[model samples]
Target chain A: MRAFVLATAAAAIALGAATTPAQAGATLDAVKARGEVVCGVNTSLYGFSYPDDKGVWRGLDVDTCRAVAAALFGNAQKARFVPLSAQARFTALQSGEIDMLPRNTTWTLTRDTANGLNFAPTTYYDGQGFLVAKKLGVKSAKELSGATVCVQTGTTTELNLADYFRANKLDLKPVTIEKYEEVTAAYLAGRCDALTSDISQLASIRANDTPNPADHVILPEVISKEPLAPAVRHGDDQWYDIVVWSIFATMQGEEFGLTSANVDQALNSSDPNIKRFLGVTPGLGAALGVDEKWAYNIIKQVGNYGEIFDRNVGKDSKLQMARGLNAEWTKGGLMYSPPFR
Target chain B: MPTVRWYNNRRVRGVLYQIIVLGGVVALAAYLVDNTLHNLERRSIATGFDFLGREAGFGISETLIDYSPADTYFHALLVGLFNTLKVSIIGIVLATVLGTIAGIARLSRNWLVAQFATFYVETLRNIPVLLQLFFWYALITEALPVPREALNPLPGVFLSARGMRFPEPVWGATHVAMLVALIVGIVAAVILARWARRRQERTGQIFPTGASATALILGLPAIAYIAGGAPTALDMPELRGFNFTGGVVVTPEFAALLIGLVLYTGTFIAEIVRGGILAVSHGQTEAGLALGLSRGLVTRLIVLPQALRVIIPPLTSQYLNLTKNSSLAVAIGFPDLVSVANTAINQTGQAVEGVAIIMAVYLTISLSISAFMNWYNQRIALKGGR
Candidate 1:
């Protein structure tokens, strides 16, 4: 009798779960009704997502979240930034604890297909690289044979380090640490010969280093490809499109020379592409269940990609990162957008 | 008649209630599983444990076992588990020794000694472990001088920003003999201890057990060293062009993690030790003194035994806490078990399976620790029930 009851209950639950729709439409509708988008970001990555003195989250990744909010609600301020660590970020996205993840998370095949998450578009083109003290007089990564490399444990940096060393047939010893700060510390402490991570991270680290940032040099060797993109949970094509187009709008704004300062002037222009982009022409916003002026709103409210990058990580900022691969496609870089039409 | 009936029926009702509660719990668990599977299906996310067999193209930073980007997800996870065990075991041993010393020092007659121990415990206990890890890693490690300007504390010992490089010993036949001698010495010490205990019980006269045990352990090893012709030789680290060429290098990451764990856990252990000692009545010490026992003898004979009874239970808990807290190695990028599992999860996208494996590994560790501690506690427990 006990076995029969247990079996019946199990069967009933299975039946109920099977019938339930897994679409995130309800979640999307709820966010829309709430009139604010909850965006998860990194808690303390300098150029990526970190809080300013006023306690407002500011970074390239944070800007991406704001851009999405602007596209959705016509106001960039309509975002709740939830700081997350690398360990907790994915779970937060999956559990609907956050509306979107705009942290500087790498886009990999497994994440896109197997993790039930969708990467919107590549926002930053990154590659794995090593940073070593300049006083070592080692000109290249090839010289790092039998060297102890400090690497973060869970990141792609570790995998790339192994692959690079093995391919080079170098007897390298990697000392894995769990946090970015530890890796930096080990590298700085002279405990490891080199520190390995994303090239952009190396740039940020170098910029943040004391005394003289020029003392440490980032090696020119680019190992694995790391295409960082904003991500959302799968099963909502409408939400996916909304995010993808929002990013595309930023790139489009940059290409059309529509800065936040001059977005109003650009809106008054007679150009068809600019007119369509700013929603001077109607019907596009209806398609995405947003206002027709979504692109204009994103640009005017959140600024263009150039503005976002410069404000967060450009030469003027502490990170002082060169717009290498993140530059526009026409300027021999990877940043390109599909036609807004 | 009614009262008699109620009493007779009570046993049956108790069993019935238990069964109903058990059934309800089972039913709820079934419902949760069903809902999850249904949601997974509706979302078209494949739910199975087969993903463990997939190729994990990601590499780990530090692995005891051979692992590569070409390895399976299961292999990566296994490597991660091994790393976790490696750090936790090392951390556990170190923390215990540090804690015991600190705990004893806290109760020392010297004001400075007690104050220092107290300070260590208080400061470490207050700060977050992750922040401490960062402070050690970033501020301390990174600030070291370069290899060219490496600080050589002694011959064959090089300290630089890269890490501490010590001499790598080249072991041969003599080394093997030395090791054998050490094992023999340990055996001799154990036999001597048993003999001393028997002598004390029978004669009621104390043998200098400590002196005898020390002699047995050290004398045997010393004699073996001389007899074996001093086979071991130091192969000191050499500073070549830019860096230390050949030596056993201890990376800063491992150093920072070790230091942080020891310092943090040692504080709690000190407090436990102090409390345990204080719990032993002043009368016990006074009685030992009244019997004309020396201060050292009084402590060794009376206080420690009683204090340890109170100390052991809480001490065991501290050890377990330190072991678990070693997981914070992820925050500092130590390739401990959790960190390694995280990489595997990210690389394989088998979140469910990966997490399950991690939980299982930790659960096993926790259970083993508890079991060992319980056994020790039982063995040391006051026998004969007073």
Candidate 2:
């Protein structure tokens, strides 16, 4: 009798599991139906994605999500952020809990293929670097041999740290904590001699998390190339293109000298490139299966790439980080967009 | 063929129900497994345990075994297993001792001792283990001084946020010989104990088995050490570029985790121990005292022997709980089995296999502990009684 009851329960669970629709390339339709784009972001990264005092999400990554929302629904407020840790980010994307992941996730071959994720475009070009207390009198990464470094687990930083130390023939002990706050806390509490992370994150942590920002110095050596990009699950080409073009719109806006303030005035501009890019010519929006005013909505709502950077982690923010490798191609950097035509 | 309908027959009904249930369970399991595999394949996640043989290019903070970034994932996981065992075994032993002491004290005639045990139980058992872990981690890191100005509390022992560094004797042939001698001594001691017990059973004369066993074990190794010239070369840790260079360092992470697990599990074990002792009737203790036994002797000889039947089963669960709770070491950066497996999952993008490995490991450990405890309980159980 007990066996019968147990089997019935098991069959019920199987029925429920079978009812969950298998995911395919319907993310765009799902987003449209749901009226919101759920983007996974960093839990508490200062400039990449974090909540402000009013609990409003704001960062470069957050703006990317907003840009996607504006491109889709023509309303930036239609985007929502789900904060994720380094370990949970990819699983969230894979499980379809989040529509897109802009959580400072690195674009690697394993993630792009093995994890069943597709990278859109490089949003933030980062590299592994070290930050140490100034009192340590360390000027270069080479000086950090035998140093115990605090790092967040489940990131490229951990792998890069191991590779760098091995290649350099240095003895390094890493305190791999799961959370950003705990990792930094360990470093600040003298449990580690230094902290290893991307230079952008190091800058953010120094500017915001530390008691004395001046006490920490970022090392000069860049150990590994960390091309951080927004990701979407594979098998969704339409949704993938939407996210790609949304970010490219921001960069193209910057290329064409458009900002959130001046984008409205550009509606009347005669520049063919600007008009074509902004969907004044109707083919671009129709191609991505969005409204004709999609690019315009993004530029107006989330601003151009330069404006986004400056407002969040650049000179306008407390981080005061330089747009060293994120500048426009015309200015000798890597930010480039294909021709609108 | 029967007078009554087949459905009305109890045997027929039972067989039919069991078959239906079995079919349903099998079908459910097959569907779930098939669905999961299909999803995994569709998502491009590489399945199987192939990744275990791949290189693990990450470092663990405190490893019990030798590990480098160049090691295979299998080797790294072995290190992780060792680390888990290291903490769990030590935690179990220390928790048992602490619990037994506290349990006895809780029933003490002295007011202060009993109140103190009560205070320890209440404070530790009420708060969450994770919170206690965080508290201990923070306290260790925040309160300890930096390595350069490490507190020298004892000669050749330094306490700092980096770790507690102490000198260790350098390993040599003499140490090897001593280890062999110690093992031999233990075997000899056990044989002697059996012989003494048998002699006491046959003859009415008592034997000092405890003193004799202690002498045999320590004296054998001592003679071996002296004969081998007693080379006492110590490797003392020295302040190096960033940390201490040599000797053993008990990291703040490991220490905090151990302290938290022991204290948290100790409280429950203490309660279990107290309950077990209390469950033994007062009559047994009174009977022993009336027969001219001391209070300590009465509790040990009469009450505890019976209490074993009650204590051993619950104590098994406490052991399992401590082992499982050691997985919380990940939260504090102790790099136990779960922590290493998580890192592997993230690196390999093989979440399914990684999780499976963790489950298998913990299951094996818990089952082994349960089996041992059961055997011990059986040995102490009353013969020819329900």
Candidate 3:
């Protein structure tokens, strides 16, 4: 037993060490020199991160990685997307399989500290919600006392589902599976009474993946606060700052009323704040060890957060998700960016 | 003293070679641990079993033991281990029975029976077990109708996408007592068979042990059951909104996994049995027939016992394979040890500890099965202690 334990401990260390032989510090230098930033994203989420018919990755999370690449090399397409499962996302980032993971991963204290990860500011504030068939007439989760819920395993959504059921004294039969497709299939086939996941994911699956989109309705009850964000490995303060500020540039761009179509027009804006942000006067990017026009390149290449959200999952997309808690602080949402000066 | 040539110094060379290998192994192990620790520390990932006591907030689809979200991780692990065992134990027994039947049928005079056995083995063994598992899981989840329109194919048996629910005997003091009585009866039957065998060998008269043993086993349990108030009532399922309540349910995951395992492993076992039977000389059956022994008696008293010796070793491995292959339950979402530990690792960020726990569990299960098979093989060997 002792030998077994030691052997496994050795294996764990070997895996970790093997991934990083000589790489060190800031990750930005290596990424820039490599000319491509490997960013991990979900493989098959409808509106978050998924490939299109042309095999081009597009979605909110995919755009975040692109925004980071734009900040660094001034080319959004320089970011390469590696699709990862929920269980694989952390290890991939931790083991240096990917430089950044903008995979709709939730930011909790345990994930931020214990997982050796540093989450950027909230990219999309989601919440735990349920999607039940319309015929069930289950308006809220409270009425799901004897429900069989299909949930994706290796996720906090499973935990929240159990908590909700136990708290309500419900006798739940959970069908916990590995992937999103399995759970969705189970829900569609009536193997489960309802499907539980993030509200954003619920909307995405229902609108795009489901056979009959109108047959299922998301429940009114929001059980848990799921502030989803992009993440990078801890340490490398320079890289962490770059990833965080990359997100902030988008939030701050939206805050200053900037869009991809009009970003070049704002380059000549006489407004002092807009000038500082677009790097008409350069300070923020150089402070973070990047080009002066980093934010300008991001806005030019990837558009701001609102535009990304709108195009990927908002009214224009099949998901049709409203900008509920993901809007700007000025619009009564939680997206507050730090001063770029 | 005559000078010993270095080439002839076997002792020194052996010692030197052993030292080199040992040193290499130690260095490798040391490197692994050192690097792993450095990486874990660098990542701030926890690396111990301390999280085993923490609450496992996740829910398992099918649990043999009482489990709640408030249960500890250790408790959850135990539940998962038991679920894996439950499927494997049941799968092994059923696979053996199915395999043995198919094996015998493969040599039957009827062409259809022989052809069907061939078909069963060729079809099932060729497809990957994981694919078979997914196929069965999909059938249960997709092909089965909703709970509201559950197919009642048999009395008190309900089949739906929710699961296959059937009537089960409600346990009570009487049932417990009867169960003990049944065990006692089985033990008595074994002793009686041994005594009867010796008596028959010495006295030149058949003792009719089989009938007597069967009677004792069934009769004792029946009497105890009757004495304890004849509690033969079954708890039948009733439709509750979207599922059947108050019956023993084989969850679709469990059903899918069990059927998949039994069907897949049984094919290999069937082939093994066929080979074992064929290994027994054909002349042995011809000789028994020439001696004017009835065919039924010849087979019962002759072929099977000999075939068992050839069959047991490979059959044991098939059982172990089935148990270990049960980890594929993770792919389909049955909360086996691997799946539960994976979720724990994901939740706790204790990858090393979680993987170690899984490795230990599967090792224990495989080792235990191997030990039991070795013991059984010893008792049944054709030669003494061979």
DockQ per model, Cα: 0.40, 0.59, 0.44
Candidate 1, residues B130-203: lDDT per residue as tens digits?
77877786654657777778888888888776678888768777667778878988898889889888998999
Q: TM-score winner among the candidates? A: 2
lDDT of 3: 0.88
The interface RMSD values of the models, given in order, are 4.6, 3.0, 6.3
Off by over 4 Å in 2: A1-21
Measured by DockQ, the strongest candidate is: 2
lDDT of 3 at A171: 82
Candidate 3 regions with alpha-carbon error over 4 angstroms:
A1-23, B5-8, B384-386
Model 2 residue A174 CA deviation (Å) reads: 1.3
**After TM-score superposition, what is the CA distance of residue A293 in candidate 1 from its true location, in Å?**
1.8
lDDT of 3 by residue, B200-270 (tens): 88997888888999998999989989999998789999997767898788888888999999999999999
lDDT of 2 by residue, A1-341 (tens): 55568777777787777667477788898999999999999998888899999999999999999999999999999999999989988889988899999999889999998888999889889998999999999999988888999999999899999999999998889999998889999999999999999999999999999999999999999999999899999888999999999999999999999999999999999998888888887798998899989999999989999999999999899888889899999998899998777
lDDT of 1 by residue, A188-286 (tens): 767677888888888888887535788989888888899989999878778888888999899989999999999998878999988888899876788
Native contacts recovered by model 2: 0.70
Better of 1 and 2 by lDDT: 2
Give each model a TM-score: 0.87, 0.96, 0.94
What ranges in model 1 sit over 4 Å off? A1-23, A44-56, A175-182, A185-191, A208-210, A254-275, A304-333, B3-8, B37-98, B114-128, B195-210, B240-242, B285-298
